[model samples]
Target: MPRILAVDVYQVAMPLKYPWRTAYGEDHTIETILLRLETSEGIGWGESSPLPQPHYVEQWSAAAFLCLQQCLVPAVLGRSFGSPEELQQAMAFVKGNTFAKAALDLAWWDAAARAQQKPLYQLLGGTREQVPVGADFGVMDHPEELLPLVEEAVAQGFPRVKLKFRPGWDLPVVQAVRQRFPELVLHIDCNAGYTLRDAELFEQLDRFRLAMFEQPLGYDDLWEHAQLQRRVQTPVCLDESVRSLHLARQALALGSCRWINIKPGRVGGLTVAREVLQLAAEHGVPCWVGGMLESALGARHCVALGTLPGMDYPADIFPSDRFYEEDLGDPPLVLDRDTSGRPVACPLEAPGTGTEPRPDLLRRWTVNHFHAHA
Candidate 1:
């Protein structure tokens, strides 16, 4: 078994190509924490973007850093774990802070994979080499500003598209997209912007025949989502609500959602994500991978998780160039198209994720850094 030798945490701010506006807020630059874990055998990298604020979830960038440096790192710094679950158990004493835990969890998984000389997906029991990915468009000032991006995504051979939905950018924006590309596979992510009071609005949206409506209610409310699901024909997909496997089971039992969006960082890294996917599979509910605008390092884990069975929906994974002009991680992620011409993302055959922060880029973007040794 490989024992953790040292850990490095970097607080980096990677500039986005444009401001990504969602229901929670707008992000001009994605401020995230990246972890580099060195083991007896090799080194591995991980990332968790809590953004600059806690509006997306309870965790934020600065808090996640402190949690890792003061809590998570100390829990398993000198420990040797045979499995990712063991590493997770070591940090079980800490409550919440899934993003902070994920930084360590992801690095352990990556390091373990590299130690065994296997692709991360293969180690995770993935059934496929590549999976289809979807393009996402954030909220724009006008439908006109959004249409061109949708058109570009379509022309680029993406199989599906996700549009950010909020109060002012709701009906009219969706109506415009539907008019332009009626047959395009479309879904809307509300980022927990609406409540059950907007059930009528969701009911009205059924006329558009979306693939699903994602996180329209409160981020932590399951009962309201269940009630909202009962009144709407479009399938409700839970994002922020499904934070853990326990929450996933509750959502399924209460009929809170028909689809689940699994993000590694949101679910405490790939260990819990795999458990949720398996749970969703057993229940016959489909699942899809979602992203947090991470650089190539984190996006690689999303791609690997997407390869598992029952991830039927196109993922929110995108190429590095989609958001960043120059990627922060080495070996920039480029989409691989299948024979059908649909854009897809594939896990690297090389050991681990085959990505890490470029030394120069890391030095340029890092606002804070912490290091600890066994």
Candidate 2:
């Protein structure tokens, strides 16, 4: 049996070039917990980067940080394990701290792949070497400001574009995008910012033939979401509503969502993420991985996850260079188009995540860091 060697946790904060706004809040910096799991064979890395506050979910960077240090880290230190799944099974008792547990789970998976000297994607059963990618355009102050970005993403060959929507910004914003790029693959992320009365808003949106209307109503309101689904021409894609395998099943059984956006950190880790993919596939629901504006290290995890077979839609990944000015390190997330002009992310060939954190950057941005002995 392979005994875990060490776990190192680092708190990293990097400034974004521009503030990205959504229905939840505005963010100007990316803060995350990067975990490095070591074995005698090698090192494996994973990231748990939630937003600074709990706008997206109840878990924030600060809370997740402590959860890993005080609760999650202590649970598995120095423990022996055959595979990442085994470690994940041991972690169920920790409860609700999905992003916190995700840091450890992802590192273990990366560690397992490192031990075998195989790509994380291959170990996770990914078929495509090049992953189809998509980019999200956050809510802007003006429709004029939003158009250029959309045009640029389209010109850069991103096959799908996700736009953020709130109450006032819903109908007109999407209408304007449709007028400009009539054929752009599009969807709107409601971020659980709307109410039942807003069903009429979606009715107007139905004419645009959006790929889906994502999380249009309140979070955890599955029945209402199912109600909205039947009333609209657009498929309802759940983001905040579906967290675990059980919630996903209920969502499916209730016809709550036609699609799902699975964020590894949001769920726990790739182990549960894979389970979500399997569940989505069995029920014929389309799914995509959502990014939290991760630095290079975290984006690499997304690249690894994108390789799975059930990632049937364009993953929400971005060109690292364009997404972040500085990162832990670079991975081969270059943007290009496939035969049908769908954006593709080139998979890393080296074992594990294939990208290591740059030491200088880590030292400069690390607010705090600690080590755990196995």
Candidate 3:
């Protein structure tokens, strides 16, 4: 039996090239808490990168890390990873701290896959070697400003492009991007920008033949989204509203959303994420993996989940080169391109997530930390 020896948490801040804005808030930097779990014999890592604003979901704070260090880790110190199901069940006793719970869950999955010498995706029932990748661009001041960004992303070979939408900027942005890149796959993410009263705007947006209209109303407004869906021709995709498999089912049952953006941290873990996928499949709605501007640790997990059979839609997992100045692994998560210049999936042949953290980069960005049970 393997005994948990130590748990370490580090706060690392990475700068973004441009400020990222959404209906929730805006940020020029990404601050994340990385979880390091060590057994008597080996180590596994995970990330808890909460969005900067509490609008979508609550932001991850240093206090959260303190809670994990003092409360969560102690409870699991001597626990055994006998089975994923059993491990997850043991975690149920420590509920309400979803972000902290997600870090532990992700580390447990990583440890389990490492113990089995398999990739995380295979452990989660992924069938494909690679999946299509897309880029979710942020909102700009003007629609014309997006043309160059779209052109650059196209040159880098993204199969699909998703634009951020706010009330005043929604229509013109979509129309301009659609007109310029007529054949490019286009999607819009409102980030819960509209309300039931904005039905007229949603009607106008239907003319663009969007790939999907994401989170058009309040994050928790399932009935409102269902109402919006009824009024608009564009298919609806839910992001912020999906906090768990139960919420996902509710949204699906209410006919509020046709697709879901599965973010492992946001939903809980890959274990629960798989449950959401199974639920989506049973209900006949397709799902896609969404990115949270993750470092390689989180990104690798996203790529792994995207390889699931029913997740045949284009993913937001672009190549590591697009976001990171320095990545967290060897043979960094590379984005492969097809003959037609669209981003294709590259399977991980190595064990687990197939990458290791770059200690040098960690040293440069990590601000404060102390080892517990070291």
Candidate 4:
């Protein structure tokens, strides 16, 4: 068995190329907690970056950084684990810090994949070398600026484009996009901003033939969502609502949603994600992976997990440069369009994630760093 030899934590703040405005908040910088676990075999990296604040989940960077240093790191530092599952069992003592746990779990998988000399995707039961991807832009106040983005995405051959919408900004944006690119694969994400009364609006908007309506109501209210699902033609995709395998089971049984958007951070770790994936497959509910606008590390993990058979469509796996001006990965993920004009992301064939972090870039952006020796 390969014993854990060291753990390093880095808290980083990287600026986005353009300001990001969402229902969550308006921000220009992306804050994250990056984790690296070193074993006798090699180095593995992961990210525990929360979505701005506790609004997405209770996990935040400051608390996650603290949890990692005080509890999570100590529990798994000296343990001998050959695989991520074993490492997950070793760290089972601490509970509910899924984002914190997932960052480490991801790193362990990367390290384990390296030890086995296989790509992380292969270890995760992935099938394709290249996965089709889509882009999800943030909320725009102007709404006029929305059409061009949709037009650009269509020209670039993207299969799907998700735009964020609030109550006041909803109708026109949907109307404009539909009119401009009638054949485009479009969807709307409200980020849980409406009520049961909004069903009428969805009924009217359904004429445009959107791919889905994402999280239109409250985050945890599955019962109400089931009611809303019956009212609209567009499928309801639960993002913040479905957090675990059990929650997924409940959502399915309740008919709460026709589709689900799975983010590993929201669910805790890949173990639960895999379970949910299997569950989604069992229920015939089409699932897509949601992005937290992760840097290369988190994105790679998302890409790897998205490769599973149940991941039916294009994911929100945009190009790295879409957010960061310069990412830490040496050859940052650059997406290419397939023959059908959809973006294609080939899985890393080299050991681990197959993307190496640039030493200088890591040192430049890192605001805080700590190391623990086993």
The estimated TM-scores of all candidates read: 0.98, 0.96, 0.92, 0.95
| lDDT-based ranking | 1, 2, 4, 3
* Whole-model lDDT values for every prediction: 0.92, 0.83, 0.78, 0.82
For model 4, state the Cα shift of residue 87 in Å. Answer: 2.8
Each candidate: how many clashes? 0, 1, 0, 1
Q: Is 1 or 4 the stronger prediction by lDDT?
A: 1
After TM-score superposition, the amount by which residue 344's alpha carbon in candidate 4 deviates from its true location, in angstroms, is: 0.9
lDDT of 4 by residue, 219-277 (tens): 77899899999999899999988876778999999998989898877777777788888
Which whole-number lDDT from 0 to 100 does residue 87 have in model 1? 88
lDDT of 4: 0.82
| Deviation from native of the Cα of residue 322 in model 3, angstroms | 1.9
Winner on TM-score (1 vs 3):
1
- Which order, best to worst by TM-score? 1, 2, 4, 3
lDDT of 3 at 95: 52
Better of 2 and 4 by TM-score: 2
Give the Cα-based TM-score of candidate 4 against the true structure: 0.95
